[model samples]
Target: MKRFALAAALVVLATVPLWVGSTYYVNIASQILFYAVFALAVNVLAGYAGLVSLGHAGLFGIAAYAAAKIMTSGHGHLAVAAGALAVTLAAAAVFAVLALRGTGLGFVMITVALGQIVWGVAYRWISLTNGDNGITISGRPSPFGLSLASPRGFYWATLAVFLLAVASMAVFVASPFGASVRGTRDQPRRMNALGYHVWMIRFLAFVLSGFWTGVAGLLYLYYNQFVSPQAVTLTASAEALLMVISGGTATLLGPITGAALVVVMKNVASAYIERWNFVLGAIFVAIVVFMPEGLVPGVARLVRRSPLR
Candidate 1:
């Protein structure tokens, strides 16, 4: 019943642009989908694998730059997007090997350091990335001759990719490998004693998480038609973490909801307040203090206690 209701809700949401009929709203919705993908990728690390990453934006930005470069070089958007995912996954494998040396705060520091390094490269590599000037994609690409330039077309394309990503991750979370990853999270020492390669499992999760994040980056590049060093900054990394916390860590839909809420709030508040970061910070603090489990979990608890449920 719950699943059916959720499916219906999604169907309604997919048609929102038809009713809203605003290019601005379509762009906003596209951003929601993009960030939702990013949040879900982070959830794979922090929520399922119990690995906290403060440097995911590094992977995200790398994928964005790769996708934009590929598209600019005459590759189809879909091809570029796929290439971005592949490169990110490969990078993740390398990162996992290096990161396996430590855990907890040590792992966090490694990721943060890696993120800074990547940011520096993106900023300094002026010939390739164009530095702080950023890169402008010539135009949106067509997959098999289907144009994706219009805002409405881009929105639909984004929605389709987001759904595909969500479905793929959902299946991944249900597979045996997923169970092994969760086992590592729950009892790493025990899993190691049981002769399981716990490091390998976590490494695989990290790679897969990077792949999804890369896909999100591709969508972001297409949606915004631009890529810059700012996209990969520590601030972006922190925003991804906040999205996971605000949505509900372990729940599949939590990250999506959290991203939507945060994006919408930012848009609305930025219109009225000059200091939007202060408002965003206040909201984050409020959520942490009063709803630590996130909006989804809090609502679920409320539903459980309700007579209607």
Candidate 2:
């Protein structure tokens, strides 16, 4: 039943460009799709592996820089994809080793420091990053000879890639190694007793998450046709965390919901209100105080208890 519902939802999303036509909202939808993938990356660590990070934006920002730099340097879209993913995964490995050496607040502090380091490099290294000016790439991103020039074209492309990411995450979560990772998350001592390398599992999860995030960054680079230091700030990382926590942990679709919500607030709601940040803060507080499990899971729990099922 859940599978059927998910399929229906995807079908509806796949038809957005066709039904909604090319407009500002369609562009917003594209943002939602890519950002949803980004949120899913955060889900892999915080939701599945019991690891929280405050430096996620750093990883995200670095990947975007890598993609923009590679493409602007006359690399093909294929190279941009491969090189960016590789760079981010390598960075993720380093972050995991440094941040995963501890848990809770210690882990959080390490991640913040690591993320800040990345930001500092981007900010100070004007020769490489062009400093705050950013790298602006020209023309459409044509992968496999298909031009993602038009809004509809890009939207469909984003959907196809988003589905691929979702499929990959689904397979990973259902695999034996994924189960072991979850086991480690729940009971690391017991998992270690079972001869499973707990740290390795967590490391792999971290790297995997980074891979997805890099994919999102690549998409983001072309989506905006620009890259800037603003993309990798601590606030961006916080927004990713908010997406995960506000939507629900340990659930695939929760972060996507959170992403959609945040995008709507940032784009639509903020347009009408002068103090949109205040509104967002209130929502965050409500999520923390009331729906601690996230809006998706909290609503799901409510539905389950209301005799609607």
Candidate 3:
């Protein structure tokens, strides 16, 4: 039944553009998918490794900036993407090293500091990032003779990428290494006594998180055709973390569900309500109070206890 429901959900996601008449809604859906990828990336550390980073947006934005700079310089899409990933991975490695030097609140603080540096550079580096003006891509890529310029084309491409990311994450979280990560999270002393290098596990998971975040960054750049310091802000990182927590950390479906809720609130509800942030804050508080395990796990628990069930 779970598998059937997952398949049905995937089918509905793939066919969203066909049924959703408005281009606006399609774009919103696209945004949700990409952001879901971002949230999933964050979840790798926060959920499985028990490492919550407050600065991953720095890694995410760096990829976009790198890709934008290269693409704007007239490079091919593949080359530009490769450059972006390379830069992002290097930055991620550095971040992991520095942030892992501390644990608990210390780790969180180090990430915040590192993320601030990235945001500062992006905001102040006038020549490369164009400062407040932003860097605009020439256009969407045409890969293997298939153009992604059209709304439907881009939406389908996003779906493909999102699905691939999801499958990859599923494999990662189910593997032996993933189990080691969870072990380190729940019982670091025991794992260390068992000859497991807990720090290495956490480091690898952080880098892996960066890799997925980079992919989401590329998709974001393509979707907006622009990259700016705004994308690198701490707020972005916080929101992604919020999605993971709100949906249910350590669960595959949680980030996606949370992303859908957030994207809808930001895009749809804001249009009708002036004090959307207040409403969103209230919702977050309510989620924390009423569904402390997150919406996904909390609701599942409710369903399992329901008389109808």
Candidate 4:
């Protein structure tokens, strides 16, 4: 029944552009789908692996810049992806080393510091990044031979990417290695005692998560056709963590749902209030204080106890 519900939800989301006549709504949906991918990437580390990162934006933003850089080189989509992958993997590997060396608050602090380093590079390196001016991707780059200049084409492309990312993550978490990683998360001491090589497991998880987020960054760059240092700052990193926590960690659908909810709320609230960031912060607080278990888990608990159940 839950599977059916999820399938139905997908159908609804996919057909949103069909029902909605406005291009604005279609663009909004595309943004949600991409952010969903980003959130899922964060979930891999924070949810299944019990690793909290505060510099996720650094990994993601690096890839976004890669996409932009690739575009200016007169390359095809595949070439752009390759460049993005190379840069992102290098960045991810470095971050994994730095992060895996620490644990708990120490790990989080390291991530924050590392993220700042990336941000600083983006800001100070005016020649490469264009500094505060941002990088412009004049026209949409074609994937294969298909041009996603239209809203519908881009929406479908984003959906396809989102589906692929979710499937990959689902398969990953159900594998034996994933179980071992989870073991490290749940019982690190026991796993270490059993020769689980906990540090390696954590490092692998971080790399995988960074790879996934790097893909999202590529999509994000294509969607916006711009990249700025501000996008990879501490605040952006915090947003990724919030998406995972608010949507329910350790669940495939949780991060995506959390992302959609956050995107929708931010868009809606920003129109009504001048202090929208305050509103966003308040919502985060409310989720942590009242819905610490996450909206999905909290709702599931109620469903299990209901008389109808």
CA RMSD of all predictions: 1.7, 1.4, 0.9, 1.5
Stretches of model 1 off by over 4 angstroms after superposition: 307-309
- The lDDT per prediction is 0.86, 0.89, 0.93, 0.89
For model 3, give the 10-residue run with minimal summed lDDT: 142-151
How displaced is residue 80 in candidate 2, in Å? Answer: 1.3
Off by over 4 Å in 2: none
- Encode model 3's per-residue lDDT on 1-309: one tens digit a residue: 989999999899999999999988999999999999999999999999999999989999999999999998999999988999999999999999999998899999999999999999999989868997889887999887778898888888999989998999999988999999999999999999999999999999999999999999999999999988999999999999999999999998999999998999998999999999999899889999989989999899989999996
lDDT of 2 by residue, 77-165 (tens): 77888999999999999999999899878888898999888888888899999988888988767677667998888888999999998
Clashing pairs in 2: none
Q: Taking the candidates one at a time, how many backbone clashes does each contain? A: 0, 0, 0, 0
Candidate 1 Cα deviation (angstroms), residue 110: 0.5
Query: Candidate 1 residues 1-309, lDDT tens each?
Result: 989998898888789779877789888988898899999999999898998888899999989898878877888656887788788888777777777678888888898988888799889999889999998987887776567798888888788888988898789889998888899989999999999999888988899888888888888887778999999999899889889989899678899998998898789668999998888888878888878899899878878999986
Candidate order, lDDT descending: 3, 2, 4, 1
Query: Best to worst by TM-score, what's the order?
Result: 3, 2, 4, 1
263, model 2: CA deviation in Å? 0.6
Output the better candidate (3/4) by lDDT: 3
**Model 4 Cα lDDT, one tens digit per residue, 145-180:** 667888888898899999999999989989998899
Highest TM-score: give the candidate number.
Answer: 3
RMSD of 1: 1.7
**With candidate 3 superimposed using the best TM-score fit, by how many Å does residue 14's alpha carbon deviate from the native?**
1.0
